[model samples]
Target chain A: MTVQEFYEEVGGDYNEIMTRLRTEERIRKFAGMFTRDESYKALVQCINDGNAEDAFRAAHTMKGMCQNMAFTRLYQSSHEITEVLRGKDLESAKQMLDVVTTDYNLVIAGIEKLLA
Target chain B: METMEKDTILIADDAELNREMIKFIFEEQYNIIEAEDGEQAINAIMENSDKICLMFLDLLMPKKSGLDVLRFMNDADYIDYIPVIMITGEATDETDEKAYEYGASDIIYKPFAPNVVMRRAKNIMELFEHRIYLERKLEKRTRQLRESREKLERNNEFLINALSSVVEFRSLESGEHIQRVKYFTQLFLKYIMKMYPQYGITNEQAILIVNASALHDIGKIAIPDSILLKPGRLTAEEFEEMKKHTIYGCELLEKFKQEDNEFYHYCYDICRHHHERHDGNGYPDQLKGDEIPIWAQIVSVVDVYDALVSKRVYKDPFAVEEAARMIMEGECGIFSPEMIDCFKLAKQELFAVTEGKFSFADVMVK
Candidate 1:
């Protein structure tokens, strides 16, 4: 997938962020940090460790990263899991982690393809 | 030097992308400090408390959360010092409420709008800067007011002492007489303060008493030179005339009294009642015991002591030992037992004054 295809698939306002930043260089720098993020991996680790608070922090951070990158599908999934963990409903949040992971993986694959 | 320095902004987030985006927006206008996690954010805030003017805190991080940082700021009283804007992925009522409760100045959703973030940060920084400016201005004004009040008090003291010297010169008493009386009054008052905490006689009151001692003989100014300057013993009529000096002094100071001028009250009491005996056998109204103001009692003992030890037209100067003996024996006038005791304790200092060694002006300097 090209950068255009990735933006189309994620349904993010790429052109808007670019215009707001006033330069493609800034957009590329933002995208570089986005590609290197480890919030999803940390979220999965916290879920496996059964640390509800840590899991909440991890999911919340992942959700924030997704929003900044304008990865709508992944942001929505992460937000759901973050809310569930915030409520201290660990079991429910654990059940939703798979959906979050799938969306996050898809975003990562699209970014990798675009960057390549 | 300070004007040459740049304002610092802190960006605290677990996501490098979030930090970079915010930094890119503010780097041109401010000096940026980045903290990768909540713990680092708190440490940065602690170390650079005076330098950092604004913060962009992420709601979630590894060691501590943005809410935790806010709580720390609240506990440490940094909430008002540094304005914080929480960066979050999604906006929820729950997170918003918690952030505000913890003292977050404002919250911004992620996907960081470059313009909105810059505008919000600038506005909050200016607001706090203005607040700090007003606070410093108020402090400086308060200091100025206090200094002027102190200066007025010092000038008032100088005028009172100048007037007292005029009365002394007119009465044919040595200028040193007023100095001796003032020193003896301070010595006695200091003992009273140390021994009697219940009286609540503050240092300020003691200074007023000493100042008023200068005017204790101001009524002598009103007497005729034929009577006041007489070197011989006075007739019964002439003695009665001399006794009226206390009444004259009180009336002279009466016109100067204002509601808040406590010094006038001290002067009035010392002038009218210093000649009164503690045994109720003394002149004027013949006020007895505590009926006479404490200031009057203090000045009364010092006046008689100075009179006995200083050479006058009517008599030769007595030794300090003889003066103390006469006062204790009630030769000059009956005094309070407590006053007599403090007088005895101050015998050495009083002797120094009579010998022209220690001066009351020294105490005034202190």
Candidate 2:
């Protein structure tokens, strides 16, 4: 599948990401790099470990990655959780983590299929 | 002294993805340096401070924060030279203000656009480059100004020596006489300045006085050979003509008088009044008791001291001790009592100069 098709399938913004990366091959390469990014896993582990600060940092980092990739679906959820954790609302962060997880999984799966 | 040919951009962030994104944006133009955490960022800055001209600092890191890096740069004064662009996923007003206060060049919010960040970086680098270029230009101009001033001073010195030598040659005296009088005037002027602050003679004024003393006999250039080069005692008529040398010197300086030139005043005063005495007996103007400028008084005594201690066609050289005693005792020429004290203070140095034991250049260099 094309990178545009993958962004569409994962509910990301193809035009926004293309505005930065320019070429399809460059977009594919950078999009594929997101598969190995551990900010999602880091966020999950920090939330489980009751570490609000590290969890906020991880969520914030993941939000940046999502925005850069134009993964708007995941970026929105990660942004919410990052703000909640920033406000020391670990309980609210845990609840929002579910939505971020669903969005992150969809983007990761699309990147894998696109790269493959 | 560090070279400015650094073509490296340092990407300091804990997130590998962020570092990669930034590297890709600038890879075509710059070599990328990756620092995974804040500690590594500071270490990278320390190791390659000379090689890295720009930095993309992530706000949040494991070991340290972006603010910490800025603080380090501020403490080391590297912030003035290196442009730091802060990149962050989330920045509040307070955090952004704090980053700027810590010397961040610009703040690029996370998911920063390639075009915008590139534009910001280029503009800042251009400003710093222009500032450095202007600074170097100013330094070069300052050096050129100083060199030309020194050259002008050397030319003035050469001109004075040439003019003084002409007068000495015309008077049938050796060339060293003018230089010796100038040296004696310098020594006596300095001693008088130390022993008598009432004169309020600044160092600049003293230097002008010494230079002007060389032209004290400049008037004698107009005197005819019958009066100036007379081998025996001058007749009353020829002695009157010889005394007109002082007035003739002032007339010669008037031909070359320069408006706004402070050096001219000292030259004119010394040439016209070097023969005047404190007791109102010396010519060509007998107005006495401080009527003669203090600088002329200094040149007057030094001129006599030099003449007595040096052999002439008219008389043999007197001993330095005898010359000093004669001046102090008011036997050779009338002088102020305070001037006699200054002469006593300078007797040792004067003797050294007369005996060729010390050169003025050595004293000046020290």
Candidate 3:
């Protein structure tokens, strides 16, 4: 479909979306809180210990913030990741988790952009 | 020096008899943590989060289903990795999948063989250690790389700050635009990275992408204020002139890279091509597909997305979905379908941040 047609289907709610981005300041602050060395390191440790549940959990919590703040891609992928774990799809969970890891850097990149 | 025994297991079962039998099976050989039910299991995990390692959970229990314990742990979101082995009489395919999805390392059937359980647990625990060893090595490499980038962050920051300010100065609009751009870019990048973390873009690369996002409009600095700040719609000529900012930003980044600096290489790619499109319709150079640097592709998408929703002298703010749909529609195939989807996902947050009035520190605090 053409850009205009696609926009017509998906762009129906621009004002609300803008408002959502504006409202995410607190959520962003919450994300920043996770940058702590101890907590961040601990989260990594949880993932490595085969506590896929814990790793998915930590990712879910962060993904939630990304979602509430409208970090759509992050929320979906993180959801996919943890969901795979939640569903017990070990191999796919790892692959999706890798996506979360790579995309997490993107989220951080986005956060850094916001800070700038 | 003796190698520290790293694997520790937590056994959570309602049956005292079962707990005792399993304890006896590995008693002196492995460090063990015991819990009566799901509640205690969770509490024990939270309390001794560090010391006790793997968990051996019984699926059917009095207080909580083995699933509940697994789900709670998945929800708690700890940084450390803890493997779990589910021991249950129910061995249905659904349960098996569910157990693995909930992060169980391995599932063990009850009425069990002690030797079999022990061997499997040991094997899974060994796999966990090997994964951690590789991750540790990667982390060490990352730490080293981050150190090296420290020297470049300062220079790149200076250049970006200077260029972004020049654009801001040219337009009498609040200088907050640069900061806003950075925030939007940061938000979008974080979303994308989390969806695809294999990029191995160091935290430093993240830092650089955000830094460079501000310079998206830096080339506007070279444009005349009369045209740059024009209250009316730009004529075709003026609009073409306006597009020069992308090239301007890229060249400035190129100048910084005169020394073959790795940091500048990143900055150069981002600055030069943030305007390129996925479908080959973007301007300045018309780079397309995988040929475009991913970060720049990300910035290009965000730049327009933000601009569409934000108030501009010539155009009214469009609805978020409309703006998102516009990006997704790809104007003329300018965005990747995958990235378009990614951008669409980020759109909700993008608009929220744009509309929300948050202090810099406030946004950064979390």
Candidate 4:
């Protein structure tokens, strides 16, 4: 459950981020945040409350965090939900929320495995 | 390692984790300020405009959007002064165009690669610092140019005054004679400026007229010792030679004429035409009425008044009252009726100035 294993588990582009940051220590610190991040929970709550604007904001934020942390699968699913909610396509966004939640769960589990 | 203070960078986002991540990335290089919402971001930018050099703005936050902050910055003209980079998780073409239109320096998508964020932020900060350096340099250069111009103007005044004093020394007249003439011309020109708005005299022209008045008798430098120093009245031929001083003065000043040198033109007019009579009967050009240059007309009245009140080798000085009468009576030479009127009106002040009863510096200070 090292940084390399986490990158491999989530299929994240570790090398790409490391090229600029140039330090595994910094990347490790960034990856460690995923364990405590609540962006996905906020997104789910907004979707449940039928607040498409706040839901879009939450999804968008999670998408960015996933991208930066190289959580490619979760980033893609969150990106899809963000676009739908941003366009105010509430029904489509509501449907896509399930897909986002599934990817979010996979990312969380992968990070937990790497940390353990 | 160095003792210098770090530049401030403001990170504004609704998410605490996002703020912390960004702060961790930049804290080593910059002094970081955190704002949890767009409103706090704006407040930080307003309060620390001088200190904060760069800003990372979250596109969407509770209460106020990043675009709202940008709108306020644009309204206050703070956007150009402080560079802003928009951070958005869901960037679209519409939002991108609007952010740029509102003066966003750049846009960075959320979940940006750490390396990409670092490079982009560093490049933008460097670019803004370079721009500020250029602006300060430009301001300093402009100030230096203004100071040099002022120095040149002072030098020009000093050289002209020195040359005018040399002319006074050669004419056997007291240096104060030229000083009185200059002051009298300034006083008369002031009255002309107020009473005759149609003349269109500017302050610059009035100052040039005063400066040039010091050289009104410069032609006497070319006059012969016998006629110039003669105690007795000049015969007809000698008188004719004496009158050529106006033409000689014009020739002396005409040598300095060059393109766009308005001061030289003033000197030429005052020296050449100051003796010309308003009634078309005076020596040299005999320029009558308005045909005479206004500067010369002003100098002519002051010169005659100064000459009459100051003792010359040829005759004793007359009283200011008697000189004013002779001018009005057309005994010395006919003048512009307006000149005569201004002369009479300014007589007491003129005498006070000439006789040392009042300082010309007081009139100048006013």
Top of the candidates by TM-score: 1
| Candidate 2 similarity to native, TM-score | 0.77
For residue B314, model 1's alpha carbon misses the true position, in angstroms, by: 4.7
lDDT of 4 by residue, B1-366 (tens): 111333899999887667776787788888889998888988998888877878988887878899999999989988876889888765579999999999998998765656677888888877877787788888889999999988987777667667878767766666777777888888898888988879999998888888888888888889898888888789999999989988898887767666488888888888888889988988797778888998999889888888888887778989888999999898987898889888877888887876778877655432
Task: List, in order, the clash count of every candidate structure.
Answer: 0, 0, 83, 2
| Model 4, position B184: C-alpha lDDT score | 86
Which sections of candidate 3 miss by over 4 Å?
A1-116, B1-159, B331-333, B357-361, B364-366
TM-score of each: 0.83, 0.77, 0.43, 0.76
Chain B TM-score, model 2, reads 0.83
Q: Which ten residues in a row have the lowest lDDT in candidate 2 chain B?
A: B357-366
Docking class of 3: incorrect
Candidate 2 chain A weakest ten by summed lDDT: A28-37
lDDT, candidate 3, equals: 0.66
Docking class of 1: medium
Runs with alpha carbons beyond 4 Å of true place in candidate 2: A1-14, A31-67, A70-116, B1-6, B37-54, B58-83, B89-105, B185-209, B232-239, B278-283, B286-294, B313-318, B325-346, B361-366
Cα displacement (Å) at residue B49, model 4: 5.3
Q: Tell me chain A's TM-score in each of the predictions.
A: 0.86, 0.96, 0.62, 0.88
Model 1 C-alpha lDDT per residue in residues B1-366, reported as the tens digit of each score: 132232899999887877888888878888899999889999999999888999999887778878888989999999988999988777789999999888888999877678888888889888988887788788889999999988988887788778888878876666877777787898899988887676678999998888899899889889999998888889999999999999999888877766577888899889999999999998899899989888899899988998888787778999999999999999889998888888888888889878878655677663
C-alpha lDDT (0 to 100) for residue A72 of candidate 3: 52
Off by over 4 Å in 1: A1-4, A11-27, A87-94, B1-6, B46-50, B64-80, B89-103, B109-112, B171-174, B187-204, B226-235, B255-260, B309-329, B337-360
Ranking by DockQ: 1, 2, 4, 3
Ranking by lDDT: 2, 1, 4, 3
Candidate 3 lDDT at B188 equals 68
Scanning candidate 4 chain B in windows of ten residues, the lowest lDDT window is: B1-10
